[model samples]
Target: MSEEGSSYDWAHKAFLQAFLSKSVMTVDEIKPILAAVMSARDPNRPTLEGDVTAPLISSTIQAINERLTSVDYEIRSTKDQTNKHTVYALVNTTSDSLTQLATTFTPDAIAYIKRVLDCMFETNNTRNREVMAVTSIQASQLAKAPTRSRQSQVGGDEDSSIQAEAAVKSLTIAESEKVLADLFDQDFIYKSRANYYSLAPRALMELRTYLKETYNEPAGDDEDEPAIVRIRDCDICREIVTVGVRCSNRECNVRFHDSCATQYFRSQRGNQRTCPKCKGEWLGDLFVGERAANKGQRRTTGGRSSNVRSEEEEEEDEDE
Candidate 1:
C-alpha cells in the first residue's frame, strides 16, 4: 500500500496499469493516466501545480525503473535529444530472452536465403552447396553488427574476420558457404540432402503459406494491357543484343549476335557447339545429355575416362 505522504507512489501504480495497455510510452503519452490518478486526491492539501507534478512523475518513473532492475526485466528508456523527450519500454533481459532474439530468423535472413536460391538457379549448378552460399549471408549479417561491442577481448574491438560489404552481390560464393554452417546447426531452415540444402519441410510449408497469404499480388496483374517490348540479350556476349542469332536448339531461345555465335563455337573443345545453360546441342539433347554426363569424366588431352562420382557413391567410399 502506498503511504498517504507519497503521491508519487500512487502515480507509480497508475503508470504500471497504463503499461499493461501499451508496449511503449513517452512521458507526455502517460500524463493523462497520471492526471486521472489525482482525481481521488484529498482537497485538504492545495492542489499540486503542473510544474510541481513534473518532479513527482520523474520520481514515480524512477521507482518503477528501480524495481524492474532487481528482476530480469528492465524499463529501457531512450532519450531523443533532437525531440527533447524519452520513450520507454519494458524489456525482458533474461538469458532465455536473449537466446530467443538471436535464434529467431529475421525477415532479412529470409531475403538473403532467397537471393542464394536465385544465385543457384542462375548458375544452373544446383549442387549441395549450402555451406557455399548460406554461410556468406550469416557472415555478412555478423559483420554488420556493431564491431566495437562485438569483441571477444576485454578492451579490444571484435575480431570478426568477415567484412560487411555494402551489398549481397558484392559477396563471393565462398563466404556464403561459411555462414551457412551456423544456420545448419540452428535446425529451423535447412534440410538433409547429399550435403546440400533446399529447405526443410517445416520451413517449406510455412513459406508456402506465407507466400499464398501475403505475396500473391494477383489482383492488379490481370487488368494490365499487354505492351510490345523489344526484350533480348546476347547470351555469349552478355549485352543488350539488338542483333543476334538464336541457338539451333529448338527449346533454347538464347541469342548471340552475328559473329558472336561463330566465335563461341570456335572456342568449343570439339566440333559441336551447345547452349551453355541447358547443354542442348544444335538439335535436341539427342546426344548432348550423354556427352554432358561423360564430359566431366573424359579427359580432353588423354583418351582415358575417369569414373563419374554419384552423391551416394562418394559417401560409401568415404565410410570405407
Candidate 2:
C-alpha cells in the first residue's frame, strides 16, 4: 500500500490470472484484473472487508503494467498499427524467450562464462587478470544470426530491449545483443576495467557454485579478485560505485551511487538539478522499476514517441 502501489501479493495475483487464462491479453483485457487489485477500500489502511467495488486503477495502470515486467509479464505495442496511437498488449515472459538463444549461444559462450566464473572461486591467482573478454567476433557469434534491420532513434532505454524481449516466432543476432544489453542493465553482467565483459559479482558467487557442481571443474590457481564482474565508475565520484541510480534524461543520463546522488542533490542548494543532457528533470526516487518508470510508454527527443517502428521488428507486417 505504499505510494507506488508496491504490493507483491497483487502482482502475484495478476500473473496467476494471466497464466491461467492461457491467452495473450491486450491492455483492454487486463484492465479489469488491475482494477480488482485497486478495488481495495482504503489503500493506506488494511481491512478485512468482503467484496468491494472501487474505481479503476487508471492512475497507476500504466505504472502497474510496466512494473509487471520485473516478474516476467510485459506490455508490448500491438504490432501492425503504425498509423494510430500506440496500442499495448500484455505478455508472460521468461529468460529463454528474452535472448532467443536458450538453445545455445554460439560455440562456447556459456561455457566460457562458466569457466571464468569458476576460476575465481578456486584461487585468486593470475597476472592481475580476471573477467571475460567480449571480443567483437565472440559477441557476433554469441549473439546469433544477422538481424533484419535496426532503428536509429531511441525512444527510451527500455523501449528497444522490450521490443527484442517479446515472444517471437524466430530469433536473430540483433535480438541477442538486445538481450545482452538488458542483462548488463539488470546487473546480471558488466564490463570489466580491462575493456571486456564478465559476469557480475552476485552471479559470480551463485553461478560459481552451480558450475562447480554441474561441471565438476577442478579448481586451478588462477588469480583475480573475489568477483568476476566489476562495477563501472560513478558519473559524479569518478570512482566505481557498484550500486547507483541513473538520470532518465537522454542527453545527460549520468548515473550516481546512492551517496553521490545525495551529495549532488545537496550540493545544488538542496534543489534538484536538471540533467545536463536533454535538460530533463532529475527523477526524485532514483530507485524505481525501469519499465514502469514512464507508464510503459516511449519517450524520445521529440517527446512521447508515436508510431515510429523499427526495421527489424517482427510480427509487424499486418494490422491486428
Q: Top model by lDDT, which number?
A: 1
- Each candidate: RMSD to true structure? 23.4, 18.8
lDDT of 1 by residue, 1-320 (tens): 13432434555666677775665567777666665555445444433334235555666666777776667555555432113255555655553332332444443343345555433222212111111112233334433323322123345333332322222233234444443554555332353323334333222222333323332233444557433212234576443332234544433556564566667777888866777767877432221111222344222344434355553443354342
Q: List where candidate 1 sits over 4 angstroms from the true fold.
A: 1-11, 41-52, 95-320
Clash tally, candidates in order: 11, 6
Q: Candidate 2, which segments miss by more than 4 Å at Cα? A: 1-109, 115-186, 205-208, 211-320
Residues 1-320, candidate 2: write the lDDT tens digits. 34434444555356445534532334454556554554543466433223212222333444555667677655443311112222333443543332323343542344333333333322211111111234334454544322421332356466665554341223355654665565566444665454344444323222332433442333456654232322234567554322345565422336565666777777775465766555578874342112112223223334434344332221232122
Model 1 superposed RMSD (Cα): 23.4
